[model samples]
Each structure stands twice: as structure tokens, then as C-alpha cells.
Target: MKQGIQAFISYTYTKNDVWLITMKDMMQWVKNPIENSHLTKGYWICQFNDKIKCSEQTSNSTTKKVTFAAIINVDQIWIWQTAFLVVLYIVIYRYDKYMQEKKKK
Candidate 1:
């Protein structure tokens, strides 16, 4: 609740394209859109293989839906959390104000 612990993940995905991507250093937890400094933590479980040399659909991308599990980790980076919260509140406050003004118009 007072820290952020984002995981490190990377992978390549392609639908009908012929190029491979190497996603690297993907931070797990992300700040809420309305908040800048407030850090959050989340987990995602899916199929990944570093040895996917061949460019094949990792999981039937053409299908209507895919099955994957999500798990949130309880680990928190205390220092970051505090910083995130401070910034988040400021942003949220401003965003709320903006929304109220838009409604009045």
C-alpha cells in the first residue's frame, strides 16, 4: 500500500505482420492516468518464451478471446509509493477540477 514493485518483462508479438518485436524493461506497476507520482503494482500471468525464434502467433491472436491469468503482488517499494502518492493527489485534484468545469459548460 505504501510502495511500488513493478516487475520486469519483455516479449515480442505479431499478428499478421512479418516483424518481431523485443519489448524490454516493461515496468509492471504504473501510475494512474490522473496521478503522476502515485505508484501502483499489478501482476499478469501469460505464456512467454524467450526462445520463440520462429515468428508464430504466440496464442492464436486471431481468436475472439484469449485466456490469461492476473495476479497482483503485495510487494511495495515504500520510498516510491510515498513519492507517487504525493504527486498522484495533486494530479487527481486538478483532473477533478477540470471535469467539473467541463460539466458546467
Candidate 2:
């Protein structure tokens, strides 16, 4: 909605020996005007292999509708993170104000 860049980082460890970390930049590219080019398209960033390589599709891209399950899964993480940071900031601000008041008195 806002005219800016956003970075999204997420990790999913379904197996004991493997970890999948996904990072996406939420910015529309001039290359893909039809669809959101940043969508994952149900693919992992990497796999357990000897030579790990990541690829990007710069052409012939189609609009991928986000699934409800995916929305719920990712939104929960951001919601909790944002709430915690907001609360932390409020607490710190209040403490600083109280300290200043005590010094003034």
C-alpha cells in the first residue's frame, strides 16, 4: 500500500536435519507488470544438495493467487512480532519519562 520497500524473512524447519529460509523483497518490478513478481509460487529457496543454487523467473510470469493457509501462517508471525515490538517501545518510553521526572523532582 505504501510507496516503499519491505523485506520479509521467514524460516520453516519441517525436518530435523533441514531448514528452509525464505526472503522476499516486496517491491514491484518493471519487468513483470501483470503479477506480483515476488510471490514464491510454491517453491523452496534451496534444497539439501551438494551444489545449492537459487534461480529467478524473469519472463513468462503469471498471476499466482495466494492461498488462505499461506496468509494465515505468515500473518500470525508478523502480528506477534509487531505487537511485541510496539509493547517494548511503549515500556521503554514510559521508563525514560519516569526517569526524567524523578531527576526534575
Candidate 3:
């Protein structure tokens, strides 16, 4: 038997955990990022502060901080092709700064 490329992938994320499950096998958790998957479509989890960890960010009743976030939603998602991302972020950064300066006038 042989395996084939996955057509669709769905993901769910919490503070400490990221789950990438395929349509084929709903039970299995695919950890590796695959090319041409839905992840490329949009929204990803970007976990900053390697030390603090998303788990630690989880909030309780009293203090509520961001627990898990989608790249476009809460945080940014990690993608395989990062070179382009760097450029994209830089452009966004510069654009934001530009907008702020324009408003300051």
C-alpha cells in the first residue's frame, strides 16, 4: 500500500497545544506542516516568547490574557516558507508606522 498527498487539513489550537488533523484520518494528529495544505490559505498560530509558552498564557477566571490565537486572529501562524513572510511582515510594519506618522501630523 502507498500513501497519497492530503487534500485538506484542519487545525485547532489551545494555549499549550496545536492540533493539525486531516480529513482522511480524523483521529490522527499530524504534527508536520505539509505543503499545499489549507494552512497556506489563512490564519495560523504564532507563539512568541519561546520561554513563556502559550500554556502559560492561558487565563483563569480573574485575569484573562490571550490563550491561543490564530495568526490572523490572536497571534501569527508559523509557515514553512518564512523568507516571504519576513518581507510581508516588514512591509506591514512599515505601513503601520507610516500610517501612525501620518495621523500624528
Candidate 4:
């Protein structure tokens, strides 16, 4: 019975220790988008060790770090894209009209 119970507990409980580091924190490490290939339209999961294993005594000390575990949904992408297109069209239209007026002058 004890062995069966232990198996049941193990099956029922699973732990996934994933840490989420915001975009702001990531910017510190990677300044340019061209440099880092994983910073494109996604939610990233970063995992780091709780404590330093070695006595490096440096400002940067971590065991592990993971990034870009998930990407933004298609619906979100469509919405943002639609908004951007609308704004871009408005700007272009206004600029064109301004240019036409200047040409007349």
C-alpha cells in the first residue's frame, strides 16, 4: 500500500520551475535586436539558479538561463498589425497632402 501511495503521489505532483524575465531585464544583456536571434514577438522564460555554485565573486553569477519559451498568439499579432497599418496609412496620407500643398507654393 505504501509503495502504491508513493507512486500515486509522484504521478499526481509534478513541478516545473520556470522563471519569467521581462523584456526590460533582457534589454540589459542584449542591446540590439540583430545581435540576439530570439527576441521576436514572444514571451520568454528565463531560468536561473537560486545561488552561485562557484566562488567567482563577480557581478554576474547564475547556473542556468532560458529564453523565448513561447510566442505571442496570432490574434494578438493581427490586432497589432492592423493598428500599425492604420496609423502608417494616416501618416502617409497626411504627409502626401502636405507635400502637394508645398508643390503648389
Candidate 4 lDDT over 68-104, as tens digits, reads 2223334354543444344334433544555566569
Which lDDT tens digits does candidate 1 get at residues 1-105? Answer: 532233222232235323211111112112232242222112222332321111112245542221221122344334444443443355445546655665699
The residue pairs found clashing in candidate 3 are 44-71, 44-77, 46-76, 71-75, 71-76
Q: Which parts of model 1 are misplaced by more than 4 Å? A: 1-76
The TM-score-based order of candidates, best leading, equals 4, 2, 1, 3
Clash pairs, candidate 1, are 3-77, 4-77, 37-84, 38-84
Candidate 2 residues lying further than 4 Å off, grouped into runs, are 1-75
TM-score, every prediction: 0.29, 0.30, 0.25, 0.30
Model 3 scores a C-alpha lDDT of: 0.32
- Candidate 1 global CA lDDT score: 0.31
lDDT for each of the candidates?
A: 0.31, 0.33, 0.32, 0.32
| Model 2: residue 39 alpha-carbon error in angstroms | 43
Better of 3 and 4 by TM-score: 4
Candidate number that wins on TM-score, 1 or 4: 4
Give the worst 10-residue stretch by lDDT in candidate 3: 50-59
Residues 5-104 of candidate 3: C-alpha lDDT, one tens digit per residue:
2222233343444444343332121222233222222222344431112222223333223222222212322331242245335433544555566569
